[model samples]
Target: MMYKMQFPKIVLIIIITSTLAVNEIRFYPVEAIPDIKKVPEEYPTIQAAINAASPGDTIIVTHGTYNENLLVNKSISIIGENPATTIIDGGQRGNAINVVSSGVVISGFTIQNGTGGLPYSGISVSGCNFVVINNTVLRENYYGLQLTNSNNSQIFNNVIMNNMYAGIYIHDRCSNNAFFENTIKNNIVGVWSSNSPSNVFYHNNFINNTNQLQAFPPMILDNGSEGNYWSDCIGSDIDLDGVGDAPFAGDRYPLMGMFVNFTLRYGSQIYFLSIICNSTISNFHFDRSNGKISFDVLGSKDTVGFCRMASPLTIIKNYTVYINDKVPIYIGNWTVSNYIYGYFLYLHESEPQRVTVMLDLPKNENPQSLFPILVATLLIVTALTIIILIKRKGKLDKNLS
Candidate 1:
């Protein structure tokens, strides 16, 4: 016999579950801020309204220019009416908007003319996981936008142009950030990374920049960059397919050549040698397709009895090699060394020594010559003399007994 459930108890449980679900889906509207305390109709500044806002409130900026450097240090959303009309100028001294607190969203405003020395930026989000979307950052004194040690941030649909350094720089422990659909142009570098990793970059257009993207110290393993349009790509499609026939080499850290040239005196020499050696041994290539750039690296060694060089070596085929790419290719060992001293020649001469080398044997050590027979006879006579001396000594001792 099954026990029957009470009808009132079942009805009470259903009512409680419905109420809990409704509470879980709560919506806070922009009007909620005005309800807590009525904002003055004619406030002098937007910062005053932000200071008066409570947690989870929205501060809507009217369609006008607010020449003030605002700081939002609370969990709130500051939405501007129009990105073009609503301008937030920093008087060229501090950040236009600094989001210090978490869960802040700054959308639909043009943040411009943020002036400071090197570290200051147009829109700086420090220690905050914020959404910076649909904004324009122009003529920043330093970086256009900078995220420091922040995680899970989204920077999308922003037009960042003419910045002094990188358009967007995510540096020093920033992780899991997403930069998508932004037009980053006319900056020193479109995007730069010092120690940041595990970030996703997609559908972004980098045009007319000195350098497109840069990553320092190189991404070793489990870290990669892909699926972004670069204007400087020059590979071809022989198959008429949209994708490139080959992938680009050194996509992630391709700026090493530029870095070396700027910093060292003889950096070009090193780069030329490196390219020749890598091309011969590694078969690396740089590919661009659908505006996305990436590197295609070849597999490990397959040749037996031949030890692979620690670094790559230059191998020229078909055409005569030139020293035009003027880089040194140093060949050596840990204890002793020899250099490949001459430049590559395109001579048509039929000199066999130019291609190979043969060793000459010493006359005393030649096994197939008459010197070996004479040496063997001398050794046999010397062995007989020693044996006879030993036998005579034994006979003399026996006679004396």
Candidate 2:
């Protein structure tokens, strides 16, 4: 009928519509209960409990022997009450715990006696991410823990021992894994990795196993091993700083020939005398002058007076030369019957008369007693004869005038 409504009635109608809209949308209280889905303890098996649980559920295993293989098909937390008491026996068939899905936590349990005829393991993790295996004991399996095509896994503080193949086998594109503070011992290979890279293995004691460690040889050729400890090193810490004095060249097959030859001949005493003589002889120098060769020994004591030459003097051999009072020079090569010590100077010339050689002795030494005294005595006699003749001629001229 196109009739106008009052202002108060319009405001009242708006308020009623807003209230209806608010009431139409459901409102629950702040302290409301979540959709709790409980897993019963009477499920009689861990697998039955897992089937009934959803994605974000925890399957708790009580203290008993669950002699069944577990396959985690979804993201779930499988916790055991006490690892030392909870046993997941594989009945000598497939893997005891196979995680096919990601984000799974399998902690605090003893996984043992698992067997697959062709190289299966106690726990086989495939294509999984963010998986944690902690405080777990894996023993007596073909492989303790086999990680294949997995990434970003944490394996810490676990004891993996007495396995058939390898204690920890990371294979086929597994990377970014942390293997820390674990006791891995008594296996065929403690840790085996084929073509895996960028992995951290630190602060782990690898002790007294049959084969403590091994890696793919070809992969090591491309990616080198850095900062690893070997239990078989026998070398000195020369600098007293805990590192080796020489670089530890690892078990490279190509260098075995050189190492064998070096070890066999390195400590032999055949060259001992030669090494000593070479060290002594390198300290002296030789020079020749005026039909006389002089040896200017830099640090020889003044007790050196005469020099002696000894033999088979093939330039420098056991060519012992001595210095006492006079310098002895040899013109030609000679073999001596006796051994002489100290410096011996030698000069060689075809015409010995063309050069004169003189030996200057120390001032304290008496030239009269030295063997070269003959030449000095002859010069004094010639001077006395010339002086007597000159005085006699002067007296004869005075008498004749």
Instruction: List ranges where model 1 is wrong by over 4 Å.
Output: 1-42, 217-226, 237-245, 248-401
Cα lDDT, model 1, residue 172: 82
lDDT of 2: 0.55
TM-score (C-alpha) between model 2 and the true structure: 0.48
Tens-place lDDT per residue, model 2, 246-301, is 43323221110000000001112111111001001212222222112222322233
Per-candidate clash tally: 9, 9
Candidate 1 residue-wise lDDT at 281:
23
List model 1 lDDT by residue over 1-401, tens digit each.
Answer: 01113433544555555455334556876565322222235456778888888878777777777888888888877777778887788877777778788887777788777776546777887876655555654555477888888878877777888888888877887777887657688999888887877666654556678987787643221123233445676554343212234444344311110000011112122212111111112222221111111112122333111111111122111112112232223222221122121112122222211211111112233344555445555555554554566558657776888
Query: Considering only N, C-alpha and C atoms within 3 Å, which residue pairs clash in candidate 2?
Result: 305-324, 305-325, 306-323, 306-324, 306-325, 307-322, 321-342, 321-343, 322-342
Off by over 4 Å in 2: 1-42, 217-401
Q: Which 10-residue window in model 2 sums to the lowest lDDT?
A: 255-264
Q: Candidates' lDDT values, in order?
A: 0.53, 0.55
